[model samples]
Target: MTAAIRCVLFDFDGVLADYDRDVRIGHLAHFLGRPSHAVRAAIYASGVEDAADAGLLDADAYLEALGRELDCTVPADAWVDARRAATHEKPPMLSLASKLRARGITVAMLSNNGLLMAQSWPAIVPALFPLFSGRAFCSAQLGAAKPSPAAYLRCLEALAMPPPATLFVDDNPANVAGARAAGLVGHCFAGITELQRALEEHGLA
Candidate 1:
């Protein structure tokens, strides 16, 4: 028999919010007076971001590295502003998270993001603040990125949730597979409608 799901671990970017890379880059570029392509290359083409996500760099180190790459200082506020500008909230998804909590199912976020994002979640997604307070886990803090079993294990440990009783929801199939590999129930999120149905099947809705 399937273990009853007592917790839901969700991915933040594509699943909880609509992320626009262009908007993020554009905001950074405008803030720093640099070209968009330059900002994009500095953030993506360079290995700085990957290192940050993988926990190889701390927040201060990450920003200093970005500043070196862009040849301009990157303060925490500007970075947070750019991130906030890029993330548009999905009311349906936020509502679903709230509903899950109301149903006695714990809701948390496990995102493949840097420590900076972990610190900025309240400002980035204020609508989710009440529901996910103290529940959001970022890859940098976990010391492992998503699609890695270590990431799921660390998050589950932090939440004090057993893998068998946790449902992992992500927009990426590969991430879902990783969650399954880590002994948690996995759901590949396609849309809010489908997710609602899936929750119903799990007796969580």
Candidate 2:
């Protein structure tokens, strides 16, 4: 028999909000007075972001590294501003999360992001961030990135919930597969309509 889902873990960027890489690059470029391509290369091509997400760098170290790559001082506030500018909320997804919470299902977030993202989530997704509050788990904090079963296991451990009774939702199939491998029921988020159907299967929607 299938265990009832008591908690729903959501992936932040692609699931709950839309993140525009171009917008983030542009914002950082403008703030640093560098060209957009340079900002993008420094952030993405440098592998600093992946390292940060994997807990190789803390918040201050992450910023320092980014600053070094961009050839300028990257302030925390400026980084937060760039992140906020790039994150756009998905109203339907937010509504679905709220509805799940109202139904007594615990809704939490788990994202493959750096510690700065954990710090700046309130600014990035002001309305939805508070709802996750203490339940928001990031890869930096977990010391592992999604698509790694360790990440899912660590998040489940923190939640004190058994994996069999939790539901993990992400836009990435690889991440979802990792969650499933960790023993949680995983749903690949395509759209609100499809997600609702998945939740319904779990008796959540």
Candidate 3:
């Protein structure tokens, strides 16, 4: 049964890496001279991040919108730096992905990140990504951010594989449940050790 699985889809942010929303919010608020709570409310409460992740807004458009919400013009690099501030890549998981690929399994990223992540993250950590074999897919590029069945379906279509043969891993339980609803095996990521255990449980690693 494990042999039937060919592709492993990983979620970024809380899984492959950790991000500091507080730091990001602080940076944005300081740069825009807005209140800290305002930054958080606009991004999380206002659904602006979702809109950007779903590709309703491109990087520039997203920036423009964010600026409008903050009532200031934000430098592109500032936005990038804000997001990148507390980003910590998980080397162990990356190494595991490399090992999986070496054994002929496909390891790809499915992140709910905006175009800035697609553009800036690679530039920020050019070497951290080569392990995934350049098979990275972002919500901004796909226009179907998860928790949506469309996003999972799009991934299967793009990979040219059936849902039964794919495994989706994410830190968010909601996202994991969404993947399961889409007919793919879903693993809610807790930590590197748990993820390694999960891969072995599924005979992937």
Candidate 4:
């Protein structure tokens, strides 16, 4: 008999929550009182490549750095708060996770998130947190980020599941490739509908 898929690991930002890229840019621009393009460039140059991806920079720090780059004074907290308000939970994905659990497949989340944001996430979306019967594998705590085999390995170790029996889903193609290299079946997530179909085809859902 073939070994069954016992676990599914999900990426957080674009997979669980529609990452508000436009809102983030707008917030930085408003804080700096500069054009969005200029603020966006400054944000990229702030030694923080993709704040959400690295999970190192919080909204406040991200806005503050952008403001300083533009020589403007803006309250970082306000900018952060506004951006937070703009975030929306992906209900369909959460429903899919519930279905997976009903079928006895363990579900987990892996994210390249910082300590502060990870800590605050449960409050924003309580349902998402509990869907992971296995705890979340956050990069900041693990000391490694995605697209690095070490991160995926750490998650596998934590889940106590072998990579071949675990399915990894991520929005980034590079991350998906890394998971495959690490021995997990990987999927580049487009949306929940496609993901549900993939899971069904793989006998995971």
Candidate 5:
């Protein structure tokens, strides 16, 4: 039998790329030449989480806040480049995306990425960005980040697919739970192998 799901939506950071939050903090600390704790506190004080969760901050504001905290002038593009350097490729998941597309399943990316990151995605992962035929959704544009029903709903509405007919994948438990609450079949992504197993179990592989 064919897979029950017609579309698959993915979260970018932890799912598509191995982005270590600690590493990021370290990088920020190094750039600022300050203690990690100080950098982290400044990040929290800058309302980074709230802005990200609300999807209201663009790349400029995001980077500017970090720059302000660090007492440096890190441009948005520079920050994007730094993140790209730290990110490790997840080829297996990319292969899975290709397989899904081959099966005539619609694949889309829903990422809570900064505007600069979104703009630079094509350069970072050429294969992944254009693979979906330009159906990638960035939170900076959508104004709603993951773990929010609004984000998932917007993605579903954009894809013109029902929640039941869609599969949502994310490494964050909260994001997975949010997708479930929004009525989509959600999977907490551990790795490509585990994800493939889950998809097979769900009869979507």
Candidate 6:
């Protein structure tokens, strides 16, 4: 709500890039030679994922733990690739980030992802940093995730910016509300055009 916004944090999966979780699940299931439901259930039930995201587990250990939980072994790279398969580029928003960055606006990404995503980011969306300039703030690395006020607040704290000086955009309404709760301006992303309109509405465009 303030005109003094200095940073724009975008959510990766649904904002800058599109991904289908079901596709990732399908790929994991196929790679493991198991049913999709079983794999999905294992992933959710094992609860190793959040630990990995929180940086409590390394990629290798995370994958190994997941395999053990599911009763199947999968190479770490293969598992990363399976997750990568779900992503599709959303270039327009990326270009917009570049544009905003060129204007001296700090553009960055924030996502509720775990360790593997941080390691697999380069392949997931090639040349992401070129557009963003700022570092990718993965929730796993932050020790907090979106939909939690701590997540947004951690980003602001790390960046050394006050909440009023940051704008957070995410596809999830809960995340948007979390940003607001953290004292940053929150924008719910629908599409490129909608986000552009939001920027203008907030006098950031």
Q: Residue 71, candidate 6: how far off, in angstroms? A: 1.7
Residue range 10-116, candidate 6, lDDT tens digits: 89888988899899999989888989988887677677877876778777888888888778787877777887898887878877888888788888788888878
Shift of residue 177 alpha carbon in model 4, Å: 0.5
Q: State TM-scores per candidate.
A: 0.98, 0.97, 0.90, 0.77, 0.84, 0.92
Q: What are the lDDT figures for the candidates, one per model?
A: 0.93, 0.91, 0.81, 0.75, 0.77, 0.82
Model 3, CA-based lDDT = 0.81
Worst 10 residues of 5 by lDDT: 75-84
Worst 10 residues of 2 by lDDT: 122-131
Q: Write the per-residue lDDT of candidate 2 for residues 14-66, one digit (tens) a residue.
A: 99999999998899889889999988888899999999999999999999998
Which residue pairs show collisions in model 5? none
Over the stretch 1-205, how does candidate 4's per-residue lDDT look in tens digits? 4456888899988897777767877875775568887766765666554553465566556445555677786564555554466567788888887888888888889887655455556654566766763477677656678889988998789878899998899999999999999999899999877888888888865
Clashing pairs in 1: none
TM-score head-to-head 3 vs 6, winner? 6
Cα lDDT over the full model 6: 0.82
Ranking of all predicted structures according to TM-score, beginning with the best and ending with the worst = 1, 2, 6, 3, 5, 4
Which segments of candidate 6 are over 4 A away from where they belong?
none
